[model samples]
Target chain A: NAGVTQTPKFRILKIGQSMTLQCTQDMNHNYMYWYRQDPGMGLKLIYYSVGAGITDKGEVPNGYNVSRSTTEDFPLRLELAAPSQTSVYFCASSDITWRTEAFFGQGTRLTVV
Target chain B: EDQVTQSPEALRLQEGESSSLNCSYTVSGLRGLFWYRQDPGKGPEFLFTLYSAGEEKEKERLKATLTKKESFLHITAPKPEDSATYLCAVQVESGGNQFYFGTGTSLTVIP
Candidate 1:
């Protein structure tokens, strides 16, 4: 089973362009998260969803938005992308149990030029 | 603010050398501590989870131990295949399921 899958493994967007990074999970996890890792930096939370129709901002959510319409999908939208938004983005899913480790996708590398 | 910090941002070890990587954290309420290994250009891979202080978990050549303020990932007789960026994360009860991650330690095991 594909635990977690993210689309557009690599993308380059011009400044002010808009795009969506797609993420889906087959594990039926109740928790989903979006994180961006900048060079030489730790992964910063962008947004998270505990379940379908519930989304909340994390540490760095200034330039991103997320929606969880279905249990299997949580997409992150970037409007008016800036060069500072360039980073490797990861999507992860975890079960409701706190002990379960989060499963991560291959990640999407976005370069805003 | 809930945060995680990993020490020795980079390390180099000879084959068969044993070493330990440290992960210090500050959280309002700790739920769990996690360890992950990430290879270049890939996402973090789960390794171990420690729930409370004095808890330890092991897999293959890796062992992880947790204390109230920090956790240590000890690698015994590490090999070249163990070279990767090791990451640490914490899930706090007060954070509403958000996990905070450390910068990671880049370990290079020379064969």
Candidate 2:
């Protein structure tokens, strides 16, 4: 159903480089989130948006920023990328009012050298 | 503060063996508990969600049950294809669109 889609399956960046990970959902969900997963560590929330034009920081938002310009898109931007930011990034969306399960995208594997 | 913890960082079981993974959580007025299975190089797949204590849900060889403090994902006669990382997450009623996740339990069912 192409529930959630993320671009750039894999990426490599040098220290201090900046890039944006694109995420889009076809489910028309109002709640969208960006999370990063590291080896042996569970997924950590980076940033989230409850609806279009609304955004909020999550547990690990130090090096990342997110924007929700439309209901179908939530892009995560990494500024001055560092090794610590090298992790798999996943985007998810859900219908908060329905309390439904969140659907996740394939994920973007980012490696910062 | 909300927190989620999963036990047995990793487990290996022979095909057809049965075992249960644990997810302990603490939240301010629990609203929902979620279980997801993630394969290597893939995003997590939603498995089940429990809204309140004493709730139970089942699908194929997996059964998830929840209590006040914890939830359990029991795999019955699992197959090698069932090998994946199981993640537990919690959402609080008072929180605003925040879901707390555990490190996850990595399970490998060997043939």
Candidate 3:
């Protein structure tokens, strides 16, 4: 099964432009997360969803928004893309149980000009 | 606030040498700790999960141990293929599944 899948493997955005990053999982996991990794930096949590229709912010959520309408899809939206927003975004999923293994997508590299 | 910190931002080891990586965290109630190995341009891959203090888990050449405030990943007789960025993360029991990650320790095993 395709564990976790993300669309638009790469993208280049102009300032103030907006786009959505799509993430889907076939494992029927209840925990989904969005994280951004800058060059040589650790992954920063942007948003997370515990289940469908329940979304919450993490450490860094200034320029990002997320919605969980279905259990299989968790999409992140970038508003007013900034050069600082340029980074590799990753979508991850895991079971509801604690300390479980997490599945990750290939990642979407976004470069904002 | 919850946070995670890793030591030795970069590391170099010989093919037969062994070393330990550190991961420290600050959380009111830590539920679990996770270890991951990430290659350049690839997402982090799950390694081991530690649930309680004084707990240890092993796989192949890697061993992970956990305490109340920190964890360690010990690699024994590492090979060049083990060269990658090793990441440690924490999940707190605060009614959520969000993970806080460290900057990661870049390990390079030379032959």
Candidate 4:
């Protein structure tokens, strides 16, 4: 059903470069989230959107931005890529109802040099 | 502040051996607790969701039980295919459905 899809499965960027990670869910879920996972660390929230045009900063929002233009699309932007930004990025979506589980996209492995 | 902690950073077990993974959490008000299984280079996959204390759910050889302070994911007679990193997450009552996640437990079931 293509629950959730993320683009650019892998990418390598130079310092000061910029890129956008695209995420779209066909489930029509209202809640979308962006998270980054590092080795030996838990998934840290980067940004989230409750619905279209409503976005909020998450635990690790610095150096990242998100936009929810439509219910199905929530894209994450890296303004100035740094080596610290290298990590596996995941996009997830869930229904508005409480207690519903989130479905995650495959992932985007980004490395900044 | 809400926090989640998972024990046994890594575990190794022989096929058919049963074991349990721990997930401890502290939140002002917990809306729900979730378990996910993640394979290498892939995103976390949903496994179970526990809402209240003393609740349990089972799927195949995996069973999840939740309590007031912690949760346990028990794998009974596991197989080599069951090896993966298990993650625990908690959603707080407030903050617009934000989730706090634990580092996770890496499991290796040998055949």
Report the error of model 2 at residue B49, Å.
0.6
Misplaced by over 4 Å in model 1 are: none
Number of the candidate with higher TM-score, 1 or 3? 1
The residue ranges of model 4 lying beyond 4 angstroms of the native Cα positions read none
**Per-residue alpha-carbon lDDT of model 3 for B1-111, expressed as tens digits?**
888999889999999899999999998888789999999888899999999999999999999999988999999999999999999999888767778899999999999
TM-score of 3: 0.97
Candidate 4 residue lDDT tens string, A40-112? 9989999999999999999999999898889999999999999999999999999999989989999999999
Ten-residue region with minimum lDDT total, candidate 2 chain A: A94-103
Residues A47-73 of candidate 3: C-alpha lDDT, one tens digit per residue? 999999999988899999999999999
Candidate 1's docking class is high
What does DockQ give for each predicted structure?
0.82, 0.71, 0.80, 0.82
Q: What is the interface RMSD of each candidate, in Å?
A: 0.9, 1.3, 1.0, 0.7
**Model 2: per-residue lDDT, tens digit, A1-113?**
88999999999999999999999999889999999999888999889899999998888899888888899999999989999998999999999774478899999999999
| C-alpha TM-scores of all predictions | 0.98, 0.97, 0.97, 0.99
lDDT tens per residue, model 2, B18-108: 9999999988888789999999999999999899889999999999999999999999999999999999998777545667799999999
**Which residue pairs come into collision in candidate 3?**
none
Residue B82 of model 1: what lDDT?
A: 99
What is residue A48's positional error in candidate 1, in angstroms? Answer: 0.2
